[model samples]
Target: MSLSDAAELLDVHKSTALRILQTLEAARFVRKTGAGTYVFGSGLIELSELTLGSMDLRQHAGGLLRDLQRRTGHTVHLAQLIGDEIIYVDKVDSPAFQAVQLPSRVGHAVSIYASAVGKVILAYLPRQERDRLLSHVVFERYTPTTFADRDSLEVELAGIRQRGWAVDNGEHDSYVMCVAVPVRDSRGQTVAAISVTAIEVVATLAKLEENLPLLFATARDVSAEMGHSA
Candidate 1:
């Protein structure tokens, strides 16, 4: 639909719609055709590929995650941010007796307000975009530890951005602890996240802190492999 039509549907002024359309066009999210009508652009298609190419990333990161797991003896996961959620693309299970068994199937979705991997991507998103998403979604509580309030969640996301990582302290699932670092593209924009999840009994905060450097290093390596850089 045209911007004016969209604006009317949303009950906004026409100029507001025009500005929104212009912004999206500038961001390459929309294309103006010969008749000045806008439609989803090639950039949106490329971004969709970047987001949904979990199989491709899994194939590429499989060996890497395995190697990392072998080196650290901890479970590793690769996930992509989709809207307000994270979808697990691949994982490497630990050989340890008490390792956490994550039910991360090929297309299972996880919440950005709860999961470490999801939070990492959300924290790096542009502030306006992040606020818009948060405004649209109800922050459902998945566990006792989940962040249920927008203000508190905003504070937490800010900290995650500053630290360059995110942690889930039994937020989405009880007895599970996770740490995640952002994976970026060549533009230095966060495109995905790499995480390690373990049973709380085996993965204490101290252990997670100790492994933080390695996790960040591995994420950087994977991002570089995907043509992403700092």
Candidate 2:
């Protein structure tokens, strides 16, 4: 909505609305579109991490995560965005791929530019938001495959959007491969993600490809249970 419209709706002056919007923009609570329009910020979804909504989301998603873990025998993770970072809220570990999974606690923050789940969430966000996030990220290469610059990362994100999934390919480490897909909300907005990780030695890109349908199907099921019809 336009600033003037928002001002009228809130019964505030245009200047006051603009100032409030600017503050929310700084905090990533709202994002502007077009010349003066605004929409709920994708980062608001990030803030959902600490809310009862996130707990409910985890509960709704747990069974699907477990089933995916059992069917693939690969570690599964449920992650939500927090600004430019992603946090693991729940996981189901595969005994066979125990070493393949990274040592992550329930709230361990992961890089949005280097991890599978992070990239998938970023890749599906509005372009302006993705650009805004890219501006703030310092591309510290974690491994040989890590994106060294914004240009490369942008290209990869575009490819990920088209492919409907993302891969870590050892960008965060040299031994693990992670595959992730988006979890949409009622509005078809990707508010979270699910990922499967395995040792590169045991599972190649082709093997990860084979699991894509399973992973995506599980993500869909979770989204559905969260009241998303999409």
Candidate 3:
């Protein structure tokens, strides 16, 4: 698709799309052909391989997520922020017959302003960096609950930071709800987020509040296992 088409499809402006395309092209993740149409570039394959090789946390997270799934009986996800998106590195689904399946894959990217895991990380970022990142975002409304205004989103992010957790109440997808906690490094820098997602019917506010401690404890354990102190 042309830049204009892509921008419209993504609910973003043409200039924003052009800037993203240019950055991806400069990083060799995208290529503009003679017709001015962009395509995935060969360099992305190399970068993908390099990233896979360096993903030690993903390796460990798989097992940890499995344990969390067993303990909580909810879908557990481990994700890291990449640019303005969150990439799910690992996930484990509950065996419960009625459990909802989350559409998460190892390299799949999700909107930072939409998902609970993404919001947790975004909330902890420096204000200047957060504003810069949000300025480039289009704030697409995926559902009725999605935060589409910058001022409202900023206020919500402030709450996430103060609470040290994030909740997605059918924001990204109308039928899904998620609760996320940050995983910090040794220096207390937020590196990623771990979340439990389920169908809205099953992931009610009361249920999420009941499970909050378990989610926080698991995140702390994962952080410590990754060589983060405290």
Candidate 4:
């Protein structure tokens, strides 16, 4: 709709309509095509992925996640970001950590500010929506490494995008660290993410770095299975 059309429909001023359109554009709900024209965005592809559901996607990525977990001897997570929360849809526990594995389960909730998986999700969101969501979050400290505010996280998210992955650095648990990469859909939109976490004693930052290539390879394989293209 044109700015005037939107103003007329909502009975608001033209500038107010423009601001509304700007927010929508930032959230990827709509894209301005011209001076006043707009159209849908690739984020719409997210709806199709959700409608297809998690069961089938789990089946597609389960074997790959298991393989990655075994190779690194760490917990592997497959999660989707729904709004401000990361929903754990699948997990592969490493046999080596059976005695002290993380107590994560399918459908567990994690905050976007305190997890490798969560940071990857936040890093890939449409900027306006990401900032909007960040504004509402209560920055409670889960660990000394946890982000104390949005500015700290904004810096972290920028690094994540630069490297195509994120690291928790014991932000969620004082003795645990996780490395994660985003999973994109066919339209090149990130719809989910996968990560591997391990106890700091055995899997420190160096270990996570060593496993980064493998972790990203596994993510690419899963994305390919989901019909995602470059």
**lDDT tens readout by residue for model 2, 1-230:** 89988899999999999999999998888998877689899768767754666688889998889999899988888898655567888988778845445665677777788888899999999999888877878788888899878899989999999989999888978787889999988889887999988787878767977899999899989989877896
Looking at model 4, the pairs that clash are none
TM-scores vs. true structure, each candidate: 0.75, 0.77, 0.75, 0.76
lDDT of 3 at 24: 88
Off-target runs (Cα >4 Å) in candidate 4 are 1-51
Off by over 4 Å in 1: 1-48, 98-100
Which residue window of length 10 is worst by lDDT in model 3?
94-103
Task: List the candidate 2 regions with Cα displacement exceeding 4 Å.
Answer: 1-50, 97-101
Cα deviation of 142, candidate 3, in Å: 2.2
Better of 1 and 2 by lDDT: 2
The 0-to-1 C-alpha lDDT of every candidate, in the order given, reads 0.80, 0.85, 0.81, 0.83
Total residue pair clashes for candidate 3: 0
lDDT of 4 by residue, 37-121 (tens): 8778766676566636566678899899988878888889999866456789998877665567686688888777998888898
Itemize residue pairs with steric clashes in candidate 3: none
| Candidate 3 C-alpha lDDT tens digits along 1-230 | 78988798889999999999998898788999899889999877976764663287777666777888888888888888655557887778766545456667767887789889888988998888788778778878889889888888888899998988998888888887889999876678787899988886766755865778889988988888777888
**Candidate achieving the largest TM-score:** 2
Model 4 worst lDDT run, 10 consecutive residues: 46-55
